[model samples]
Target: MQDKDLPDIVDLVREMGAFGDGGRNRSPGNSNSGYGQGGEPQAKPAPGLPAQSQAAPDLPGHLEGLAARARTYVEAASSPNTRRAYAADWTHFTSWCRRQGLAPLPADPQVVGLYVTALAAGAADNAPGRAAPRSGGRKPHAVSTIERRLSALAWNYSQRGLTLDRKDRHIATVMAGIRNRHASPPRQKEALLPDDLIAMLETLDRGALRGLRDRAMLLIGFAGALRRSEIVGLDCGRDQTEDGRGWIEVLDGGLLVTLRGKTGWREVEIGRGSSDATCPVMALQTWLSLARIAHGPLFRRVTGHGKKVGSDRLNDQEIARLVKRAALAAGVRGDLPEGRRADLFAGHSLRAGLASSAEVEERHVQKQLGHASAEMTRKYQRRRDRFRINLTKAAGL
Candidate 1:
């Protein structure tokens, strides 16, 4: 075709939205007849000139980079458990935002405030086949849970270099007001007494291997103030010995019981390597040696054939179930003066039991329990104190 007959590449590029500099199609020249009417070839546009069309910006790449940086900041600022929790919390927040017709980026403070209110109100329905009410429905959430979600959001925003002002402050104040107004009246934790503990321990019939394992598990759990995950992840060979004189080095000090908490495993000193000092650690060692658990999960599921099968670590729910079963077996049932039913015991009861037993130094109790602060320890101690107070009142104190 003649040069004059050829289509304009510039016009084609513009139509195709290739206007950006360095953004040009790489196709070769036209393959039409070489000879033109005037025998002149068409000149191409200067290489420096941008193609008419511009591809969309690298939005996905930008977002991925942002996510990586945010992850790094979260890792530095908090424990792995906290990071995981915050990630989940933020996911909920973003899901809520999508439902509210807001983009995940550039979260408006007003919208954030509304989200906080919604969270506190528990107005967002997650049930299947039930549409969330636009105005009002469902009971409000506990103040503490709401506050935790808000804190997670604020931390997420701060990590992204966003400013948190009146909206955040308003939410904070609302949470504080809720806290102050209710003051929660100090609810008592359901704990097991010494006799109850013994009953639960003894309920595990020592005739069978699984029975012996369960008994050992309950005893060590109560003795060491172990969280469910910690109990399940206990390394019999490394964490403790046949004599119970080893250490339990968790990942993140004792604040979290996840695998990520093992920041090179911070060891907790127990009994002497070889001595008659009766320590709980020693008890753990004896339990391990007797159990003959050389490797795999400290707690195992019993099979139909009565074989102890090695398995992955048990989750928190399994631990709770174990505790509940043991509680039922022990036949210890009665509501305390606080009105809390005796059936409410779970794995956490073991930790609370240890804390309650430590009636001497509160700080020592907190340390043993791996609580971040004494206030948390005090919360655990409140029920015992209330029981004591009631007894004193009954005695005419």
Candidate 2:
């Protein structure tokens, strides 16, 4: 369908505040367990910090106003998801520092090294922080989590115009040692094959509105090879809502999904399937028509006893839960226990499923997935089914 064919549905916009500039101005030594007077947790100020106002006294009033507004844009530079994660990580780090009676700011190399070591040894987990101390005292973090924490620290420091010397021997040596000791092969999610997808779909009640939304989500997500965020971030049409990360357009023969992915903007073409039961386009159209989703988020909450649809978009976590629940109910891997099956399947399974199921060239798969390299796309081609050309058979033995 063309843009002019879109129905006139008013957008429901939600207000969101930008995350504090990584708590750049918060001091580490404020009492109340390192929190402000109002019981709100305070942040630590970076060392060598300059005056807060970017607007100088010498500037004109309007220019100064513009200068002040610049900080808001600066804070908005990072996405909310990213800022939230960084804030949590920062809070945890500061809390650890307070318990250790050490300084969190100035990005001290020796102290940072010790902090990372404690994380690897599980000692940091027990530190009094934003998160409650777990039942088990010392729970070591995974290599990936540790790395993310380090990146968070680096980003937080940069926000305050300070530099974290990650390359310093104290930090670098310990990281290398941690990798040598704790690194393991990456455990990938189990890819859902075409038959597996059909089985999972059978578990959902197609008669209900909730079922229609979910069925469309699963089918579209798999067919478009979309990420969980990409799936829920879609709008019925372009510019329908300010918050939508992407938009959809239905063509005569297929569906076109234009998204702002990690690799930037790209379009995914999902052609019509052989049957209505399995076709992603058909499923999406049915959901949209039944849900009355003329604009705004394509996938939304089904409220009022599964009879009514809400304007609020579904959380990305819902996608993961749905995939797991469906996979478990369908008994996708009958050989495995229920717990393992639940753990194995996730939102990424849909993307990986498409990568595994699509009988196409490597380059085509890579383009569809918007992967910068074929190696990245191949990583999603889980199981032995997608390994179509067997080199062993061609080589004379």
Each model's lDDT = 0.54, 0.77
User: Tens-digit lDDT track for model 1 on 243-285?
Assistant: 1222343232221222212233333323221332223444444
Q: Which residue pairs show backbone clashes in model 2?
A: 1-250, 26-43, 26-45
In candidate 2 the C-alpha lDDT for residue 99 amounts to 81
TM-scores of the models, in the order given:
0.61, 0.82
Superposed model 1: Cα runs more than 4 Å off? 1-84, 126-137, 158-169, 176-183, 186-188, 237-287, 295-297, 301-305, 335-343, 383-397
Report the lDDT tens digits of candidate 2 across residue range 168-284. 999999999999999989989999999999999999899999999999999999999999989999998888886788999999979999998887889999999999999999999
Q: RMSD to native for every prediction?
A: 15.6, 8.8
